[model samples]
Target chain A: MSLLRLRRASLSYPAGGGSVEVLRDVDLTIRRGEFVTVLGRSGAGKTSLLNLAAGFVAPSSGAVEVDGRPVTGPGADRAVVFQDDALLPWLDASENVAFPLRLKGAGRAERLERAAALLRLVGLEGHERKNLWELSGGQRQRLGIARAIAAEPEFLLMDEPLGALDAMTRDRMQELLLKVWRASGAGALLITHSVEEALFLGTRVVVMEPRPGRIGLDEGLDFSARFLEGVPARALKAEPAFIAARERLIAAIHAEEAA
Target chain B: MTVSATNLPERAASRFPSGGRPALPAAFLRRLPVFAALFTLTAVFGLWWIASARGWAPPVFLPSPDRVWKAAQIAADTGYASATLGQHAAASLGRVMAALLVTLLIAVPAGFVLALSPVGRGLLDPLIEFIRPLPPLAYLPLVIIWFGIGEGSKILVISVAMFAPIAISTAFGVGSASESQVRAARSFGASRFQTLRHVLLPAALPSIISGVRIALGAGWTTLVASELVAASRGLGYMIQSAAQFLVTDMVIVGILAISLFAFGFEILFRLIERFWLPWSRRR
Candidate 1:
């Protein structure tokens, strides 16, 4: 069975008088350990799709399932890293990262040890004591990623985690995310407005449309050259093949908007 | 608009250190003029004390500092004619704490319910609004009727005084918890109770602590009114009895002691707040 599935999912929110549809009959599936990137413009329901998978919002119709089990609500098996860091303001870096495990009643020592490892994974080794406010924007976002992955869930859902970061930080985060995903081998569904990011990280990229949001196109990515060795993500971004793929995805998004 | 550093005169520092230190002592030394004024006032008081010893002012009207100090010692020795200052202070502290505890136990949960449940807020908010504006002193007669002229009456009076401030502050705090924080907690598979414990309460802490500070001040003021009715052993009772006997020095001592207690409590609360919420100290 596919590790996760969304069958004809549609989400709607109450508008001025009638409900405004955000997603419409969106069907997607991923096998175990696959990386799927969802690409679209702002308000394209890419986030809504991720939110459905995260169980932040219930779909109006159809179903969201994880590993053949219905995703009736958020569960431990699926962990989400929101676009905004959403780190609890009162907690310092270590506590925030250890929160999910703390909820599951892990011993304090084990939780801290695991959280420290993940913090080191995200290059935040010495920032365990710094309060959320004291962190730079990029550091806070990295903490958000660390927190999400701390549980080492079967599936990871990221909603444009690096959108708010500067170009340098965002690029750095992309490489870090790929490295973490490679090491953990967790199935990841990433949602992003950045086409270049989708092309780089996703094993399969699903394009989405706006208004009544729906999936428009689906394409597979080839990371064949670096399949054995770690892919240098920045150098790949400047390559002709990667740029051509990015242009194609950008064109697809704009075409849907124009239509 | 460019400013030239050359146009400004440079001042020499007594001891300058590079980097690391924040110059906190320099900030303190900047307030020397205010400290000097206070020192001058103390010197003037000493001059008056010497003049009073030489009969510069009537002894009956203006008791010499030495005489007042001697009387204070005598009062201490006699245990304030019945109860010692220690006894009075204990009674006052006990009553205030008891009242505050009862007030918080009822008010905080009530505030949370009122903030979260629309039905509860609607049903209770109007009644709370109605009762709140009525001053704590105005409840004295009712409390006396209900609890009689005893410890119960005094506690009821202080609790009533503190209840409104605590409730209002708690409700405001809970009502104003950041929406995003609640949303974030909920998205993490947390149920409603978990959200309340993990997100709402912690977020509301700063406001609730401020409310406690304000409520403590109100409770202290209510102690005066509470004792005025039928109390025999407190700072208020001491002051009132001294006033009747025309012992202004004793009255002043009582007043000073009460003020001192209030000031001490405020400092204690501020220290606790700093320890608990260091994030708020900068702002």
Candidate 2:
């Protein structure tokens, strides 16, 4: 509930005849109410970093710990929002959201109530019974979040949840994400290739380096915090300070790629 | 061909005052395939009628459609080989459906195991492959020897013939779940069983329905082969009896009945798919 930490974690996959190191002694942490955005070029182990934190893959060296306990496998404490949305097409909106509850052995009535409430929380109340295919990419992503949060996990791990949305919807979804984060008070770790998205959303942003991926830069930012303090997202993002930081992160990623 | 030309913004409606002969009416054009089917049936029937009337071979060899129809009426009245046409038809249908049910229960679970567990696949994959290519006739005698020439053996023969398609298709459907989908389920604390139930099962449904479609065809075909061994009341038995006595019209009637019944079930399964997995149609 308080802290999720990766303590010098590394992962490598046996490929061909040799092993390819995916993450090299990566160190990171997210506290409750903190939104940590990871930004990097492709192959920078951004996803591997999240996978370690979410316990989808075991770190070959060191450890991922939520609070202080070592992470072993995927659990109810860590829910992930996949880039592809990954909502079951066979399930309607409400049923998809209710899935986590069902897995946890919640009774049908309780699951339905929780799902219906989460649908409202995600601004998908009226579309509860709608098929997943009928929902737009943005709406489906929102439903994915609802499903992820259905179990009230300690942390929310998202892999480019809004990466597929059109520009207008992406911008709108960014604000919605902040709203949900503020409401849930769950620690969040999101990875994206977009520097502006990283700069705009993260309370702390971590930039990753590729080819034996490692952390290149880690810093705290006040933009998302300020937005949560009732500043309009557009006005805050248009600020000169925001523009300067976005440029700096973009430069860092490109500079790493060139290296 | 002129669709693009007529749709251009620069074109005026008056440029084609009659809308190009009304384009053969959209509904009528849509039914063109139906017309083609009807035409083919009629042409075949006409050719057969003409051939029989002119003594093309002998009525004993190629019976006219009316002769087949009269044979059907006569079978309905006097029965064939100790059973009426209705009874024979019912017996054939019952055997196939029983085999289908048995195969579905066994084969679907076998499919799930073969797909989910490597050891299960290792154990079952070769067996399914072994049964897949074995014609029902090849196995019918073996089944009769094992289970005896009773309803059980006949059903078993048909069920074994259906086993491979249903099981293989189930495995194929189970494999269709995306990596992220499985990962998502696990992240929600879904156990292996829960994941299989919630994600893999529904994901496999469209494929399972299709597998059943193929399996039903196998079931019907194998029903005839199975009935070859001491079947007293089936369309296949009636046809076999008719063939021995040179009742060519009755044989034609049996073949037509089987074909029509198979075609009817195919349509029925399609409608079930439409109703149950309506989302599958989006693809």
Candidate 3:
């Protein structure tokens, strides 16, 4: 069964005197354990779609269903990793990772153990006691990922989680995320502007058009080599299929722009 | 190609000392200059003692340091004004602490409500603005009429003095937390209350602590003002009564006690800030 689905959803925001439509008639589905990436331009309402899925905002006209339930408000079932590394400044790495579990009323020992394990997963084992302010930008974002994944949410929503990292760190985070995702077998809806990232990490890629945003194209790639464990991402990018997929997405985006 | 030069002395100084142990206690103590502080205080006292000996300054107007010390010892032995020196100092401190506690309890929640909820702000902003600029002493007449020049009046005076700054700073701090933090919290499935608890409150803490510090200083200043009008027991009462009787030594002692209390409270608050908000300890 599909783990998450968005059906003919429309999202609008108040602007000037009237409403500005951000997303219109958007339909999407992700099977359990499938990784999907929503690729779009800067103003293509990709973040709005992720927000709707995260239950931060509700669809104006349609339904956002997650794991067989209609998403009304945010719940622990869906966790978000934001682009700007939104680890709480007052909390150290361990406490930040344990926030969801803490809110769920888990005991200190249990949450601390779980948090320590998650920190290790993110290669931040020794830095668990470090405050968010003391960390480098890349470390903070890695901690953000740990916080999001600590709860083992069924669906992890990432909104350009590596956008702020420099090239070296970004490459490392991308590798780390793919490894974590495969090992955990959790579903993800990654929102990104990078065609390379979409091609590399996603089982399927959906291209979104600008303005009254709608899916411009959708392509499936269930081939095992693209997102397998122990496969370097650069090798995948160098593949002929990967280059073809990238060209196809660029053509679709340009067509949407011309139209 | 140009040759680069290196400074051996500068590099040696920059390197960590060998053995990786803390510096010797004697070396650290020498750097502290305990004697310098003592010498400065003693020089001031010597100048005052000389002036009194020469009759260059009136003894009653500015008592000799020795005379002030003697007067303090006597007051400590017996009592200053109506109570002992300890009793008077305790009374003033107790009032300030009680008033501060009450002000914090009331202002923090009110400030958060006002800043978070628009309707709350709309209802309270006018009253807050009206009361903010009026000196707490301006309420002295009302306080006397309502509480009848007793402990209640005194506490009310300090509470009134303390409340506005605490509330205003809290409101400003709550309002000043970046919208991005709020948005990020919401994205993580946090409810409105959870977002406030997890994100808003912690982000506003430094400002709120500063507000408390300011309120404490204000509270101390108003302690004597309140006692002057209403109290029969406190440092202000001791100073006022001593002045009436031309006990210049006792008045100086009372003034010194109040100054000491204020300084102590400031240091205590700094220590608490350091302990609880360790992330803010930059250097």
lDDT: the better of candidates 1 and 2: 2
**After superposition, candidate 3 runs with Cα above 4 Å error:** A222-225, A254-259, B1-56, B175-193, B281-283
The per-model DockQ list reads: 0.39, 0.73, 0.41
Determine which window of 10 residues in candidate 3 chain A has minimal summed lDDT: A222-231
Tens-digit lDDT string for candidate 2 (B26-74): 6875565667778988999899999998889798899877889999998
Native-referenced Cα lDDT, model 3: 0.81
Candidate 3 structure quality by residue, lDDT tens digits, A33-128 = 888998988889999999888787999999999766798877666778888876776788898888878767789898889889998888998887
Candidate 2 Cα misplacement greater than 4 A, ranges: B1-22
- Tell me which residue pairs clash in candidate 2: none
Task: Show pairs that collide, candidate 3.
Answer: none
lDDT by residue for model 1 (B1-283), tens: 1111211212223344335865567656566455666788799888869878888878766777776677666556675636776666677778889999999998888788788899998987887887777777788888898889998889888988888778877888786666545655555556778778877787667767777878888988888788777777887777677778877677666666777887798778777766887654332
Which lDDT tens digits does candidate 1 get at residues A102-142?
76678989878888999999999998888887889899888
What i-RMS does each candidate reach, in Å? 2.9, 1.2, 3.1
Better-scoring candidate (DockQ), 2 or 3: 2
lDDT of 2: 0.88
